[model samples]
Target chain A: MPVIEVNQLHKRYRDQVAVHDVSFSVEEGEIFGVLGRNGAGKTTTVECIEGLRSPDGGSISVLGLHPARDRAELRRVLGIQLQASELPDKLRVAEAIELYASFYPSPADPRELLERWGLGAKRNTAFGNLSGGQKQRLSIALALVGNPRVAILDELTTGLDPQARRDAWESIEQIRRGGVTVVLVTHFMEEAERLCDRIAVIDAGRVVALDTPAGLVAGLIGGQRLRFRPSIPFEDAVLTQLAEVESVRRSGPHVEVTGGGDLLHAVTSALARHQVVPGDLRLEQATLDDAFVALTGPAAEN
Target chain B: MNETASATRTMARAPQRRAPRPFRALAVAETRLFLRDPVTVLLAIALPSVILAGLGAVPALREPADVFGGIRFVDYFAPSLLAINIAVLGLQNLPTGLATYREKGVLRRLSATPMNPSAVLVVQLVINLVTVAVGTVLMLAVAVYAFDVPAPRHPVGFVLTFLLGTSAVFAIGLVIAAVAPRARIAAGIGTVAFMLTQFFAGVYLPKYLLPEVVVRIGEFVPPGIGAFQGAWTGDGPAPLQLAAMAVIAVVATAVAARFFRWE
Candidate 1:
């Protein structure tokens, strides 16, 4: 069974609709990504699922429990790392994990959790004294202390440096490997692409697309761009006349080919027939970044 | 990474697993944090007693005075010191602590746990109440033992008055905690309230010297000094004053319940 199911979820702050219509299901152990822009309502949706906010419309079932009515039960089993939640400045790292552990019926041992999360050395460190990456890791560790079946992490790496972001990605993958379902809410497409098993792209309070990283790129803006320098002079029609070639353009000594449907094999065979060696050849496909922009549209800039 | 998963799995499937008590853990953790702030503890626990000792040191205050119902000023002022502690803590200490928790997202994070976020505030209230009780007792003991001030003649009245006044004043503080959008604002408002509360309670000056209108108006407001003072004096806890305290407690607590937000 899906660990979390949010159907036609709707929420509003006053008259402003924060989540217009959102729907998805998190599989038992997959990293499900909720990809969206800043105001695209990803946080609102997850907050509702975490029982922090109630949806104005539609129903949400987390571990087969209603988020609103079964809030107490759901909280016991669903670990949540909120976007801007923070601990007291004086709270020590180990104290925090141990305190959260007390809230669960059966929780991971704080000492073991600290060691595994690489926070054993900083166990006595105050929250304010910790570095940014350490704080993030600590929060993630706290979320997992409950030994929850599902964990929802929002804006996981918004302000971290690149190195910290990489480290966080590894932690997330590790969490998934522990048999916990993960819901990752983030505006950073790179994060979703690298870590998420399947991403639901939310745009302006709606799920615009839902698929794996490569699937999102392929389904939304599916195509390949081939760039190469030919060893010998060749006619443009030799590539353009073929079915896979959409257009042919020459920039300096390089011929760029844009097409789909096994274009690499088709173009390579055509070049071989003409006795032209394709040197410095590179094939480029649209990334999740491009897919996000294409799906969210230009309005996301505002 | 493999170590991380294996460690987590092992801990999860460990034998002898049982739930840790949340309330005790939160209380212990909260007390540790409270003790870390030496300045706040000093102000909350020691300031009242120090002020009482200062008043007791006044030689003229030991003399019987008609202005203070023919009793020595030390006797009357000593009991009212408890009221002062209540106001300072309720108006300044409690509200700031709770609002800071909300502003810092501590309350919200706790809400995400199985334990309700309001449980933290409850624990906080208990801690503050206990602190005031212990601090005020110490303050009173020093004055009684050192300055020869008599102990409260009405023990039942003293305890009742303290609980009533604390509930009323802390309820008012709850209003500030409920409404303030930020921690600094809550502290700012609480400080202003504290000043106003002290004025009515006659902290800046003795009540006999204050204007009739100020005293009359102060009777109806929080920390209701009359009830608090009466409890400490030989004969006090006037029925009218007790009723007033009860009303404030009920109404303010209701308002706090309606308006309080976790985040």
Candidate 2:
């Protein structure tokens, strides 16, 4: 059964619809990605699911329990790491961890959690004194302390260094391997592609596309793209003679060849037959970035 | 198989785990934080003591037909200052602290946990009450030993007034904390309210010396006006007035709770 099921979830701030008729289900132990640009209503939708914000319309259930109606029960089994939350400036890291642990009926040992997150060394440091990455790690540690069955993480690596981001990704994968369902909301296409089992692309408060990253790329791009910097300027006759070349387009000095199966070999054979070789030959598989650009019309500046 | 059984045992033991320790932990943490601020500590202790000493030094501050019937100024103002101390902590410190927490997103983070918002509020109140109690005791000690203030004419009346007055002001502070747009606004409101109480409620000045209109206005304001009747003048007003004030406090607390923003 799906650990979290949200159907036709709708929320509005004043007259502006924040989330409009959104729906999705997160199966047990799956890393589900809710990918969207900033202000795409991803956070609002997830917040409603977490019982932090009451939905204006539709129903939400986590582990078959209504999140709003059964908030205490839901909170007990579901952990959340909000994008921007803060602890008191004077509160020490260890104290903050222990305090959050004490809230639950049963919680992971604060020491163990600290050790796991490599935050044990800075346990006595005040929250405000910690670096940005340390604070983010602490937030993640707080979310896991409840040993929740389902964890929701929003903007997991918005402001982390590359190494910290990689570490976080590994930690998330480990969490999923441990049989905990995760709902990851992120704007990073690479992060989503690497971690998510299924990706839901949200745009303007709606899911514009939903599929596996590879599937979405394959389905959206239609065929493979061959990019080459030709040694000699090519004529239409040279391109039309290639057997696998379905279409061709040129911009500046670059040539793009579009076709189906074994298109790369066909292009190479045709180029060799013509005694012409490109200076830079590359076969490009469609990526989620390309798929996002195709579907959303323009890549959102991150 | 052994791991599974041990895990099952742990899960079963989880439900029977001890009650939440966040409140106690937060209280100790908050008290330590409070003490770390030297200015706050000094204000909490010095405000009442200074008032008590200053009032005791001035013998003419007492009126011949004092409301206590024959009570000295020191005897009357001591408990009034005790109420004032509670009011200062509750109305001033608590609201500003809450606003700061909201500004810093501390309360928002806590709300996301299994701990309810009420638990955080309760912890804050507990810390405030403890601090106020200590300040009250110290003030009382100084009043009796150094200042020679008379003992409570009616211990029950004094206790009742202290409890009721603290509740009322704390509720009022909660309202301010909940409704104030920001920390600056809360501080501004708290300062204005404190100054109004000091000037009009006759904390330092005699109420009889004030104009009739001002005295009439003070009749309704808490701590200063209410403390005069409740603590200073034992025969000041009927019991129903105190009851009405308590009701107002309760209503204020309800309204504050209703409008409280955990953000």
Candidate 3:
């Protein structure tokens, strides 16, 4: 059975609709990505699933239990790391972990979890005294301590440095390998592309596209792109004569060739034959970020 | 697989047995944090005690014999001091602390876990109650031994009045925390409210000494009526006024729950 099933979920705040008919299901042991710009209803949808906010319409089930109706049961099975959530200023890192663990029916040992997250050295430090990265790590450790069947993390690597972000990514992968399902909500394209098993791009409070990163990139805008700074200025007629040259565009000092299959050989052979070797010849593949921009247009601005 | 499943089940059931520990831990955590800051601890406990002691020292501060019926100023002011201490902890201290918690997103983190918002609030109230209890015991000890004030004629009545009055004021603090735009604004409002209650509610001076207009206005305020009639007195106020105070406490609590912002 799917670990989470959200069907036709709608949430309205006053006159504004925050989530409109959003429907998706997360498979067990899968890293499901909910990608969206700010105000795209990602947080609202997840909050509904976590039973923090009541949905105005439709239904949500986590681990075969209704979220709002079986809130306690849902809380028992699922853990959440909310965006911008905080602990009391005076609460120590170890105390915060212990405090959260006390709420669960079966929680990981606080000391063990802290040590595993490399927070043991700073365990005595008050939450307010910790640096931003340390705070984020502690928050993640709290979410994992419950040993929940499913973990929901919102904007996981938002404010972390590159090294810290990479460490967090490894930690998430470790959790997923331990048979825990993950639902990640993030606006960072690189984060989504690197960690997500399958991503649902949300736009204007709706799911605009959903697919694996490679599939989305492939489906949105064909295949490989051949870009080069042509050694000699070529006319449109010369570019069209090359095989596998589906489309060509000139911007400033370079020429961009877009197409599929054997394009590299065709372009290189054409260049050699004309004695026109490009200064910088590079092959570029369509990325998730490109697909996101293409599908949502400018409205998906993060 | 079956053995692993059984192990998982056992692990899951373990936490249920230890659920209450977290609530106690949280309360202890709050108490430690509250007492860690010397300034705040002083403001919470010593401020009311000092004010009460200072007021009791003045001979002319005593109420007329007709009103208090030969009661000493210390006897009259001691119970009110107890109530004032509770009010400060609940009405002023709690609101500001909760508002800062909300402002800093502390409560939001607690909410995301299995901890209910009500649980957090209960822990805070419990800590405040403990502090108030300690302050009351110390204040009463000084009143009896040093000031030679009479013991409460109706101890049960005094305790009930103190609990109800504190709950009412605490409820007001919760409402202010819930509705205030920011922590700084909540602190400002709490300070202003504290001063207003101290001045108008007869905690600092008897309502009879105030202008006729102020006395009339004091009748409508809960703290004023609570201090006047709920504290140790010859006969206390009418049963109807006590019932009104109880109702106010309940309604204020309900309103606070309605508007409470978890984030």
Model 1 achieves a DockQ score of 0.77
Candidate 1: Cα lDDT at A258? 85
The DockQ-based CAPRI class assigned to model 2 is medium
Residue-level lDDT of model 1, residues B1-263, one tens digit each, is: 99899967875666456656998999999989988988888888888788877877888998998888898888767765666778778888899999999998999999888988878898889888888888878887887798777777788887887788788999999999999999999999999998888888877777888899998877666778877676677577787887888899999889988999888
Among these predictions, the greatest DockQ belongs to: 1
Off by over 4 Å in 2: A222-224, A229-246, A250-254, A259-279, A299-302, B1-23, B54-80, B204-208, B224-240
Which residue pairs in candidate 1 collide?
Answer: none
Residue runs of model 3 more than 4 Å from their true location after superposition? A228-245, A249-256, A261-281, A299-302, B1-20, B55-72, B206-208, B212-220, B224-233, B236-238
Estimate, for each residue in A175-252, the C-alpha lDDT of model 3 and write its tens digit. Answer: 899999999999899989999999988887898888998778877544779888988876766667765677888989
Order of all candidates by DockQ, from best down to worst? Answer: 1, 2, 3
DockQ of each: 0.77, 0.52, 0.49
Overall local distance difference test of candidate 2: 0.80
- Model 2, span A189-276: residue lDDT tens: 9999999999888888888888888878766643679888888765756766766667888878888888655788878777777777
- For residue B37, model 3's alpha carbon misses the true position, in angstroms, by 3.6
Selected candidate, larger lDDT, 1 vs 3: 1
**Pick by DockQ: 1 or 3, better one:** 1
